[model samples]
Target: MKVLITGKGGQLATELIKVFPNKFDVVALSSHELDIVDAESVERSIAAVKPAIVINAAAYTAVDKAEDNQQRAFDVNYLGCENLAHACKAAGCSLIHVSTDFVFDGKKATPYFVDDVPNPINVYGASKLRGERGITNVLEDAVVIRTAWVYSGTGNNFVKTMLSLMQNKPELSVICDQIGTPTWANGLAQFILHIASKYGEGERQSLVPKPVTYHWTDAGVASWYDFAVAIRDLGIEKGILKQAIPINPIPASQYPLPAERPSFSVLDKTETEGSTGFKTTHWRHQLDKMLDEYTEDSKLSEGKT
Candidate 1:
């Protein structure tokens, strides 16, 4: 199968390329290489590549920055997706769009299900929601997967930020009230590949009889404080950090940003699990795996030096 992936250098995109099966022909493009926001460029690229499926990993992910730059956010997250959907339709191919858990207002005490109505509380979330709507409106069979708290060894994510802070600072403060599950980009990448393979093999009906949204994240939930604690402990154990530091738990009000985040953005993955026949791993466990990879890579780099 010929697969085209956007946002080639991103955490999720990098993982997708790393874990992709050798049987598939993958064409991964960075934003500079294939600007998704440009409708004409998207159409031309899809026509030239003629991929069997276009997996859109491109997105404007700056949550707080989106508040100040709504136009750029919508151009990338919303219109970029619309362009991809239209281009995919023209090319007679399918689309697999990655979305986010922020679409929910975080009012629900429990997990947000696939069919739950979205009420985004921030510009970033609202833009992503609009992108999701654009995809479904343009293409009937496109797959939309919403994930949360994603991190990988290669990107600027919560895990890396926490690790860096733990090494440099004597203390850190993290929000304890906001809760959600962390998703490893590697795991999410594998799940996406599974869906693409199924679709490419003419097993789309088994996965999705119609257009659907799926929620996927690591199995367990935790607050930012819990996540930071785990990162601190794990970093020390893996020799990624020299010592432990005090991590203080704080409410969101104590440290405010331009964006209003969902207090409880956990997503329910029951349908995704059943459809893909893949079991979800716990967030801490997935973190350990990623740290292991990071540790090994760090050692290799040191050796090279």
Candidate 2:
């Protein structure tokens, strides 16, 4: 079985490779190897590898900055995906496309299901939704997985940012307005690779390598304030920090940003449940597992040996 992955440098791609490095003839390419912005490069790379399965992890993910860089964002996210989808279709290969939940407008109180219409409020979100459309339009055998609030053992993410600020500042202010499910990149990588492998074998008779999509997110919803505070509290309890000061909660209006984020972006996993017959790990469980690596003392003290 052969698998090709774009965005070799991205956080999620890094975790994906780590968890599933042995699963296939893994070809991990970064921007330097195959610039997604250049259709020629994308085509040439795809033609050269012709892997049985392609996992596209590349994207223009800068949220606030995308407001001023719409063209750049669209070029990389939408057009690049178009290139990839077209290439995969030509090769008769399956594609596993990753997407963001920022595509929603955050108007609903409950979780957004797979069938909900995407109404992006920002340039980044719009670009991602456009990319999703591109994949669906171009590829007959594509699996779209939309996820949110992702973090990993490596990378600059919410958890790392919270830990950094907690160490440097006496107190911090985080907006309480935005809420979403946090998905662990490692866990997601495992699930996707399992499907990718089956795709290679042409098994999973009931599942579609064709025009299918699912929402994959960790269990439980959390406001940005809630997530940040939880991290600080856990850090203190685990003795990763000498002390954790108060993390102040502020309204979204009080802390304005360049991008208009969805106040809510929770994704319902009913489709994922039906397909995978498994549920995602809870956010607390995922975070605790990652945090444990930083607290070997806590592990030993708790007699986890």
Candidate 3:
């Protein structure tokens, strides 16, 4: 099966290239190679690749910056998605769009379900929600997988940020009130490949249902402060960090940004679980695995030096 993935160097896209099933002839395109914002470019690229499936991992992901760059965000997030949907429709291929949990306002104390009404609190969220709508509007068999708090062993992410900060500062403060699950890119890549494989076999439509919008995250929820503390503790345990720094828990008000965030963005996976029969590992466990791999890589590099 030929699978074309956008955002080649992104955390999720990188993992998909490295770990996706061997049977797939994956054509991973960087933003420079195939800019989705250009409708003609997308159509041309899709036509040339003639892929069985297009996994759209490309997105405008700067949460705070999207507030000021709404035009760029909409162009990439909303209009870009619409372009991809049209391209897929034209090519007779399926699309698996990676969305976010930010589509919800996070007003509910419980987890956000698939059928729950979306009320994005910021420009980024609104843009992503619009992208989701655009995909479904154009293509009936598109899979919009809404995920949150993605990180990985490679690339810039929350884990890397926390590790760098802890190395430089003796103490750090992180937002404690805001809550969500952290999803590892490797796991998400696997899940996406599974869906793609099913789609290639023409079995996913019966299993996933039409206009599929699924929620995916790690097994447990945590506030930013809690997540940071875990990174600090786990890094030390795995020899990925030299010191255990004190991480202070602070409210979101203490560290205000241009964009307003959803205080509680936990997504429910009941529908996804029922549909795919796929279970995710806990956040802490995933964190440990990533750190372990990081530690191994560091050791090998050091030995080479």
Candidate 4:
């Protein structure tokens, strides 16, 4: 199988490349190389590569910046997917788009289901929602997997930010009110590969049904404060951090940002698990695994230097 992955240097895309099986021929491209926002470029790339499947990991993911740069967000998130959908349809290949859980407003206290209606509260979420609609409209068989609170050892995510802050600051404050799961990019990457493999084996009807949207995250939930505290303790245990500092829990109002996040955005993964037969690891376990990997990588880098 020949797979083309966008956002080659991103957290999830990076993990995808690392975990991808050797049986498949993968072509991962960064935005500078592929330029998904350019319709002609996307069409030309797909036509030339002639991939069996195109996994769209590219997205405008700056949550707060999306407020001021709504046009750019829509351009990349909405128009980019639209462009890819058209290109995939013309090229006779499938598309698997990675979406976000922010499509929900977070008004509900429970985990969000795939069938639940999306009512995004911020520009980023709204733009992503538009992208989802665009894919469904253009290609009915396209798979859209919505994930949340993603972090990896390779990128500028919450886990890396917390580790940096804990190393420098005496004490830190994180929002306790906002709640969601912290998904390790490795896990999401595996799930996407599983989907691609299934599709390659001509299991498209079973793997991707109508209303092809699904939710995936590591099991368990945590607020920003909880996530930060876990990072601190794990970082220390893994020798990634020198010591743990006092992490004070604060409400969202205490640290307002340009974007309004969902207070609770836990996604229900029942449908995803049932369909794919893939069990999810808990967020804390995944965090520990990631930290361990980070520590080992740091040790190797130091040895090389």
Q: 255-294 in candidate 1: lDDT tens per residue?
A: 9999999999999998789878988999999999999999
Clashes of 3: 0
TM-score against native, each model: 0.98, 0.93, 0.97, 0.98
Residue 286 in candidate 2, Cα distance off native in Å? 0.2
Q: Provide the overall lDDT of each model, using Cα atoms, as 2-decimal numbers.
A: 0.93, 0.86, 0.92, 0.93
| Steric clashes per prediction | 0, 0, 0, 0
Pairs clashing within candidate 1: none
Pull out the clashing pairs in model 3. none
Estimate, for each residue in 1-305, the C-alpha lDDT of model 3 and write its tens digit: 99999988999998899788779999999999999999999999999999989999999999999999999999999999999999999999989999999999999999999999999999999999999999999999899999999998777899999998988998999999999999999989988877887877889759767798889998899999999999999888877789897888999999999999899999999889888888888999999988888778878989999
lDDT of 3 at 182: 94
Report lDDT (Cα) of residue 92, candidate 2. Answer: 82
Better of 3 and 4 by TM-score: 4
Runs with alpha carbons beyond 4 Å of true place in candidate 4? none
lDDT of 3 at 262: 93
Off-target runs (Cα >4 Å) in candidate 3 are 301-305
